[model samples]
Target: MTWLFNNPSEFAKEMISGFVSANASMVRQVSGGVVRNTASKPDTVAIVIGGGSGHYPAFAGLVGQGLAHGAAMGNLFASPSAQQICSVAKTVNQGAGVLLAFGNYAGDVLHFGLARERLISEGIPCELIAITDDISSASADEIHKRRGVAGDLVVFKTAAAAAEQGATLAEVLAVAQMANQRTRTIGVAFSGCTLPGADHPLFNVPQGRMEFGMGIHGEPGIRELAIPTADELAAMLVDKLLAELPAGISRAKGARAGAILNGLGSVKYEELFVVWHGVARRLQEHGITLVDSQVGEFVTSFDMAGLSLTLFWCNQQLEALWFAPAYSPAFKVGSVIKAPLLATEDIEAPAEESVAAATPESQAVAGQIVIMIERLAEAVIKNADELGRIDAIAGDGDHGIGMERGARAARDRAQRAFQQGAGAGTVLQHAADAWADQAGGTSGAIWGVILNTLGTAIGNQEKPTANAIAQAFSQASHGVMHFGKAKPGDKTLVDVLLPFSEELTLQIEQGHDLAAAWQLAARKAELCARATAQLVPKIGRARPLAARSLGSPDAGAVSLSLILNAVGETFPAVHPQGDTLCL
Candidate 1:
């Protein structure tokens, strides 16, 4: 369990600050994450890597001369926002191009893919490569669907080394992909990891049993068996990893491979070495030459008493790159001379033009919107635990905290925007950005899309009428479906949103009052949200354990319903065609 936290909300920020301070010689603080302190060769491709917090050394600790040029760190167990990724990529760009590398988790895939698009649009060439190296996560034929685990280190290292050699972005991307395809990892856990300030771990293993093929975010393992001796555990890991060889290598006979015995979190270095002894013996028996063996923590799930083994099947080219001289704050290869640290300078984002002036009537509507947002926040906070519990049934248990953070941030930003004489649309837009920036997850990204679409539909020029609100709801639903790529019945917020928006549009077309239409639509959303309890998750991390969520509603769906109902209660009594906006 975690301790010594000043504030649970500020833990990630404080952790980043302390990490940068401790490694001043290796990295400097950037807007989104940390960048290498040493200057790089101009026009060389910059390799930027990242994921959620709790996995140290795998990310920021690898930002140095011979590793990642920069890292985009996010909140614990959450992917970084697209804006955060963009900020770090821009800061690390060296005039030539940038390459984004990360694990193949859904949230990371969505956010990083979006950031790549944004960067490319801005004329800064960028590419993305998601590492899928955990063999246990999927079948050998479905390697692309595998989750990245300890093997992320090998892929990141290869790409960073290629970039350091001044390879073009395409070359670096090819190297990263090659490494990913050649690497395979398998992990087993003795227990689960507890998040900071949480009462219990996200999931737990039975006493005297070990969980096999577990995730780094405290996700339960695929199977469980009675705990074995250290040597037996090591043999199990080695056997599982070696069972599926890379495409080029049919067998491991007379082949060279790089190996890593990684401690998930709480496992001691001494214990890792004990396991490695058995792993090394097995490799030798199998006629596989161990080129470079690493035994310690590389990628980790916080305080999880578990370990993973990664095998990188190396061809001639991969072997050379794998053994190449490299230097980083965490991992290092052969001799590396100390490089001069670059002077620290604040890199501020370009300032936005001021918000447009709002009519007095629109400004009043904006004030009402702020109150509605506050109510949303209050409802979220009140039901945060239940949301988290529902999510924990089949997903990471951070949904409640993430929603709380986004709701509070949205409310705060809406208040500020309203005070600045902004209209309803402008206020919602600001809140949307703030929610995505602070929440930093798939749900956050979807919320940003919903609010931004609604804001755009209800522009600042006029008071929003029932017809306009219905159109905005329709647009919001379409935007979310397009952005999240989640269809109705995916057991996501989209499930609730689609029916609500459709009913809202129908009600408005039937000449209902604004308040009545909204209330009716909200009821539809509530029913849809409750119906999610009978549906299985078809996306995100929960997909693997879809059956486990059979009786629990999607956390996003529940929160959406709660917020919509709260907003409906705040609607004013007014006619659909009245001069005053009813909601």
Candidate 2:
């Protein structure tokens, strides 16, 4: 359990503040995260690594010489916003391009990928890579789907070493890719972790049983087994990892590898040593050589009482790079030459975008939008805990908090934009950006796309017609389907969105008013959301443990339905007496 925290929502913010204060000599706080305090060589490729917080020493702790140039820190178990990632990359880019690397998670992929596109458009050469090293997350045939665990250390370290050696962006990317392909990890947990101010852990293992192959974000494992002794557990981890070598070695004999026994939060260092004792013997018995083996906590899950083993198979180049000197607040290798304190890097603010003048009719629409957003925020806040409970079954247990955060952000931004004499479209656009930036996850990105696409369809100068609103819904649906890559029956928000959009268009085509059409479409969405309970998730974090999600609707689907209902309730305000301009 997390014993010390002020406000629950401020936990991530406070953690970043304390971390920066303690390591001021090594790193300094930026708008979204932290960057190295010392300067590096001119034109040296910068390596920016990050993901959700809670995995201490993994992201922020590894930002220094011989490691990452900076980190884009996000909320607890949530990916950093695209704005945050771009900020850190721009701050650290010297002359050479930047390399963005992070663990293989859906939220991380969406946010980082978006940042990469934005950076490229700004004339910054940026390469993105997701470290896929957790063997338990996917089968060998689908290794690209695997998520990174403690193997993050190996991949990040290897890539950073290449950058420190003045390798080009392409070279650093190649080394990082190779390192990820060669590393494999498997983890188990005796207990789950509780978030700050949470009443309970995300999930729990039965007494005398252990969760096998659990993730770092408090996700339950793929399977369960009886607890074993330290030696037996070590053997099990080794056997599983050995069974699936990186497609080259037919056997373990004469293999050289770097091993890490990572303690996930509550596991003591001494206990890890005992497990390492068994790991060493198992490797030796198989005639495999362990080089520069490390035993400590590198990546963690707050207070999850668990551990994992990461084996990095090394060729000559990998061996050399793997053992390279590194210095950070939480990790250090051989001595590294200290560089001079960094001159302040100027982080420029974005230029304000001018809002086009809106008509009185559109301004009335904007006022109604603020009220609708308020209702949406209220719904999300009220149901957050239940949504979180459902997501904890197979996901990282953050959907509720993420929804609440995004909805509230959208409400605030919409109110501000409306007060600034903006139109309906302009207000929605502002709200869309705020939701994505504050939420920082898969849901956040998708919601941003939905709102922004819809906003563009409803132009600022005119009062939107029923036909225009229906077209907007169709475009938003298609945009999300393309952007999120989730189709109907995927057990995602798309399951609700696609149906709702289609039904809304049909009613509008039949000459129904906007309010009437919305009412019918929202009901369709509610039914679709409830029907998702029977589906097996085809993608995202839930795919590995899809069976566990049975009998419960997808959290994303459910939340979308709730928001649609909330929106439906606001139509009377938009169309006075149910007969106002067919709006």
Candidate 3:
């Protein structure tokens, strides 16, 4: 659904046409998948780049002054044929020779290898530099065999600079190889990407979850789990990459490394920054210093909501070449400096704190009330469209999608608990797990925690009274505060929850019946939710878009009021003797 192309074949040709038209001055289209540009200087070694079409600014955009002399392109997510590579080599090869710099994929290896042989037969000297930077794509024993990622840029830049300086083909290849060896990359995807003209995505990631170490072509990943906060995600990626580095590189090289926070596509600049901030902080904690950092949509997959992190350990020579001036449609060197200082050992030590843990009481009641909760969760899921429409008034329309996805997951968990003959506590815990796993945004997790907390507070409590309801509400509020970090007046669900809790407590203390207290609480919640229209949001996704949200009640708060009112409507006022009480 994301792609607008008529077909994959047409998409490939259209992109090539646009590329050639725009880069006409810098490059000339050759037969097959190749494009050649004049080198900055005659007699300088030439660099040849090649890759599939999806990863833009890679094999194609890098062709220009002080970069690849030509590029061999391929169809979407498919490698260029050997003939394509050979054609590129023949067109670009001069007396000085050419160096093939490309990522390490099976298709690339097969075709580029064949091209090398063909070039040799034609009496044209050609060398190769295979970049293997994706540390997460393979095991430790296979690290050198992993696929390349954004770090390919470092290899291309370094090799091109060396070639531009008149290095021989072998020298250029060696420089590129060194850069490839020193570089490492790892990526995570919040969702899978659809290929051009494909209705379905290459793979499907469950809503509210992410896959760690996913391939560009939607290959299976290391694991899939609930989407973590930007900080948590950054830490996970940096930790994996750091673990794969030479054991003492940090101490030996003073931990100098360049970082590329690349958006896979559809990931906003703000989200990228949030991830980068965490990455930067984590790198510092590991005594790794960031020399230079770039954040943008350098390489994309047609609106895939994912990101890749690349790190290159640099020595003096490689560092010099990295900073060397170069011009290309996609890349430019603006400033150069010596590597930054790494933090001291004491400062870089890992924090000892743990992520907050769920309580024991919630685990107890989950088993007995599984069916009731499952039904409630199903109702929420069914109303997802309506919820989304309400949220669209002042927020991103994803709220409905997020809530529906989360509720279904929770309902499934409740059903599973019932089937497994689990207790009420287990059911609550399972529901929380399902909600977090299915609903990816901040609100889903908060609501899940709230439900779990409420279940815990009322564990096995039968014939619930006003006091019991107040206690459950209080606990739920705590869970929301603990997870969301929003206080009263923050224009979050807490804005509604706090007022409801206060009213419930007051009514119960005044000896009001259970249903009467709930009705009072529901009224207070509605008033509080409506009042949020006048207050500015101070938390979550709404905070940044607060200007647009002015005069609109907080969507979560409004939903909370509605749900509470629905519950009150279902169970009206009842006296202690269980007789219907008049309004």
lDDT of each: 0.85, 0.88, 0.71
Q: Could you give the candidate ranking by lDDT, starting with the highest?
A: 2, 1, 3
Q: What stretches of model 3 exceed 4 Å from their correct place?
A: 34-39, 247-253, 334-583
lDDT of 2 by residue, 214-316 (tens): 8886555668999999999999999988988886666788989999999999999999999999999999999998887999999999999999999999989
Q: Positional deviation of 497 in candidate 3, in angstroms?
A: 69
In angstroms, give how far residue 37 of model 1 lies from its true place: 1.4
**Candidate 1 lDDT (Cα, 0 to 1):** 0.85
The TM-scores of all predictions, comma-separated, are 0.93, 0.93, 0.56
Model 1, range 300-335, lDDT digits (tens) per residue?
Answer: 888889999999999888887777777778898986
Best by TM-score: 1
What is the overall TM-score of model 3 with all chains considered together? 0.56
Candidate 1, position 280, lDDT = 95
The positional error of residue 550 in candidate 2, measured at the CA in angstroms, is 2.6
